[model samples]
Target: MRGTVWVASDIHLGEAVPQTARAFYDFLGRARREAGTLILCGDLFDAWIGDDHALRRPPRWLATALDELRATAGALPLWLARGNRDFLMGRALADALGARLLEAPAVLDTDAGPILLAHGDEFCTDDLAYQRFRRIVHTPWIQRIFLALPLGARRAIAARARARSRQARRSKPMAIMDVNPAAVAQALRAAGCDTLIHGHTHRPAVHALELDGRAARRYVLPDWEFDHDAPPRGGWIEIDAAGIRLEQL
Candidate 1:
């Protein structure tokens, strides 16, 4: 953290999005060359049933992704955080790439300053249904049961849940899909940090706020979509002793 730290999130890599996979690999290469420490905030994969799938019988795409990740980790300090979609990403995946698993809402004392980092889904408190689903899936016993099932079974269940979630999202209001202001305030207070960085909503921006007569800032990371999107958006946050900046890819 003495040098420049790079952060990005929501790449959503999978077999279907080969373009995105390639773009991410290229980004990893750039990070390896440029960053002192690289942190993937979350959603690096579209769906990660378990690390066993990658370890036991990785498909060609997964194999390539892992290779790129391993190469990057070998060059620089790499950290992976779990997102809602890839919450199953665990020690197995981290160990494979020689990367450390980052706990959400991780506070970092960096060259720029102390900052709070997370996947950003937990702040969507306005989405009650999604919150409930998150709570259910996040329960240790529930996750244990799910992980105990065969990989095929787990994949099928995850697919169905994702489908249902997409369908439900279609009917939900846009406001409900975004983070709650009160939740943000509470998180800032709880973390005792003025600067926060996270990604999940896909709406990227920087915000200024006042908490307890102190200035605060929140940086929302952008999602990467290269296959279907017209422009193929992607970006990362760079932090140095000078300050934090959002850099487009």
Candidate 2:
């Protein structure tokens, strides 16, 4: 927390993203050597039915990803934050990886300064339908019921939900898919932080603005999609005494 910090998110690692997985493994290796603390902001996987399912029978790709994460955790401090897609990632998975679970919207005190960090989905208040679904799935009782079902049933449900989400996105306007300005301002003000870092929306950039007569910045982390993205895309944010620096691969 007092030295260099590296943050990345939305790798969406899955059976299909072999190239992205390799790239992420490479990033983990680099982070092991160069970063004092590493934070995986969210969506490390495309979907996470449950920790039990993963721990019991991880596929080849997941097993490799877990091994690299465990190695990275052994090398230095590693933290995981749950993303919208991987909201089921729990303490069991974190413990298995030798990493700690970080609650989203955590205020990280770094060498550069204190910054608000999150998976960046809650800020997308404009996506009302998705927000409603988020509320339902986030409900403890609902999650318990879902988790209690057989893994195959859970997988089927998740697949249907994902299909619905994709269809919804196709019909919605681009603006609604991104974060809302008011929501961002409120979060920064409530947290009393000038800098906010998060990943979602897949649009990575640094935005500067004035809030309550004070200058503030929001750093949007990039999503990794090396397999099919035309030019390939992935990146991370590095923070140190030199402040924030964005690195891409």
Candidate 3:
């Protein structure tokens, strides 16, 4: 094909150390020219809640920056998956952007093959508590209620939720944040896909595995970082006719 399909995830926009806005906008400029479709794995925002298009609240230069991408990416397909953080993205924003919001375990056809895309949280078979919570929260009834809450209320709830999540993460082992190998195999087999793309663990790499009767490849996208106490190890995923490439800013 003549275009590239950009895949990136875990932008985590709310962090204070440094923002990925600059890198993200820079990538958008290049991706618009080369990518026919852009798949955002998940966690596009650091802390997002409510369905209203409150993106006007983006930090001073951020909103204007993103508008440039909208202009350049006109009519290009942008498929976005929701992470634990941005689960609030709803129809209104998708309609405005002319993009599609994909749920977890999304199956897609790419120049590469029939591929599976997900946030990868559901495949963490080891995290029993989180899996249970995810089941309840992702249910249609709970999601509807959450989306219907006033924006301010949703924001407040998200704040508390985030705090608790941080505490839990501290108490849990590192392995709990990663994908389960057996679960990965099972999921790919069910989707009948030979490739999977996901972002959640923040450990970016390309992995190969034999699942079902076929071999499968998994690409783990990375989170963006910036110049702070921690050097900017910012990362992203990109695929073009030349092949797939990943760069750390």
Highest lDDT against the true fold, candidate: 2
Which of the two, 2 or 3, has more lDDT?
2
Candidate 3: regions farther than 4 A off: 15-18, 53-62, 65-69, 227-229, 240-243
Q: Model 1 over residues 162-229: C-alpha lDDT tens digits?
A: 89988998999999998888898899889888999999999889999888899999999999999999
On residues 149-184, what C-alpha lDDT tens digit does candidate 3 reach at each position?
A: 877788788889888998999999999878999899
Q: List CA RMSD, all candidates.
A: 0.8, 0.8, 2.6
TM-score per candidate: 0.98, 0.98, 0.87
Compare candidates 1 and 2 on lDDT and give the better one: 2
List candidate 1 segments past 4 Å from native: none
- TM-score, model 1 to reference: 0.98
- Whole-model alpha-carbon lDDT for candidate 1: 0.92
Sequence-dependent TM-score of model 2: 0.98
Model 2 RMSD to the real structure? 0.8
